[model samples]
Target: MAVLEGDCEDSVSDSAKSCQTQSCTNCGGDGSCNMNSVCNNGCLPGFYSLACAQSCGKCGGNGSCNRLSRFCDESSCLPRYFGPLCIQLCPLNCGGDGSCDFQTANCLQGCKSRFSGTRCELSVACPSSTCRDPCQSINGGICTSGCRSGYFGEICNRVCNCQNNGACVQDTGVCESISQTTSVTVPTKFSDGKTAYQRAPAEGDPNNYGS
Candidate 1:
């Protein structure tokens, strides 16, 4: 009476355990053992259902699907692909392997000769600005979470100020805007939104704008 899943007594033989891949015969594929040793890990990619007899829609990059409920991987699709699990392909002349926008599937590299559209089929979406935050750098004037690697700023709009691949502080903005040889103007407006021209009341200096 094996009742605690994989905690089966070593006395039980492989034949009695189900499959060699450690897959459950009850699950028809990879699965964990239940109290009765019934597996439930689900089936291989592109398969579904208890018997694992169903086929899934075309997924991105031929990725896998939820074998148990048929849920699809929305982000796994390769370039030129879109829709749920990337089941759909971009237009024929969408240009550049259909590496279109993820949201609209519009090409980002522009259209081919004699073919034209407002977006040129070449497109892209606001990619993640930071791994920990969503990207809306264009729409949002300021970064809510922070900047991505190799970048730092309030809105994540400014490029890495350091040369030779140096890093900068987030709120400090202390890094050089460019390499030593390059001539570039630095931006003002400190972290507190005050400039060198503006006198601080705390410093006993006369305020320029208002009290």
Candidate 2:
């Protein structure tokens, strides 16, 4: 009887040890076991592993990582950050007013009127004093507003020399003038419509009016 009781106690002790081993292994040490004995607690936010021991890659604290794959969740990236791991920053700060492409970092909208280039990093080249009326029809180095007085041509770099109160053509820089000439004529009138005849006897006279 003593031997039998001892064996029974030993058997109970072995059973308890087995139960504890099964309970601990159910969750693979990576998650908590639920009431149904199913592993459901999953790894922490940025960590993933069978035992929740590995850390997620650097996501600049802007996104969450997948528990199973340890990859960053792009949809959760911070405002200005983008890319697979949310590691890249949007370029040009969206040119101050526009937005940037989340994947390519390119500008979603065009730059402002005062700016140009793919990233809007370059300033629009407006005409200067040398070109006259810098803001008039500004287009790079070309002076579409036309040069100021005394200046002419596409760049407004050419000087003009108009003569005799002449003005230079804005497009060609050629001198132009507006001068005119006039003439006058006088007509003689006769007292009578018929011709007058002098007497032949008076031809020899020294005081003849016909002479």
Top TM-score model: 1
Candidates' lDDT values, in order?
0.50, 0.48
Best by lDDT: 1
RMSD of each: 17.7, 22.8
What would the per-residue lDDT of candidate 1 be over residues 88-168, giving only the tens digit for each residue? Answer: 776665555656665576665555433446345323233344422754322223455667655666655555655554555
Cα displacement (angstroms), candidate 2, residue 180, comes to 30
Report the C-alpha lDDT of model 2 over 1-211, residue by residue, as the tens digit.
Answer: 0011222342243443332222323233344543233345655566554444556554435434665776675443444555666556655524444545556655555554445455556575543464556533213345666666665666666765543323456688764432211111233334765444433222133322231
Per-model tally of clashing residue pairs: 9, 0
Worst 10 residues of 1 by lDDT: 178-187
Which lDDT value does model 1 have at 204? Answer: 33
Off by over 4 Å in 1: 1-39, 118-211
lDDT of 2 at 44: 51
Q: What is the lDDT of residue 66 in candidate 2?
A: 65
Q: In model 2, what lDDT does residue 74 have? A: 49
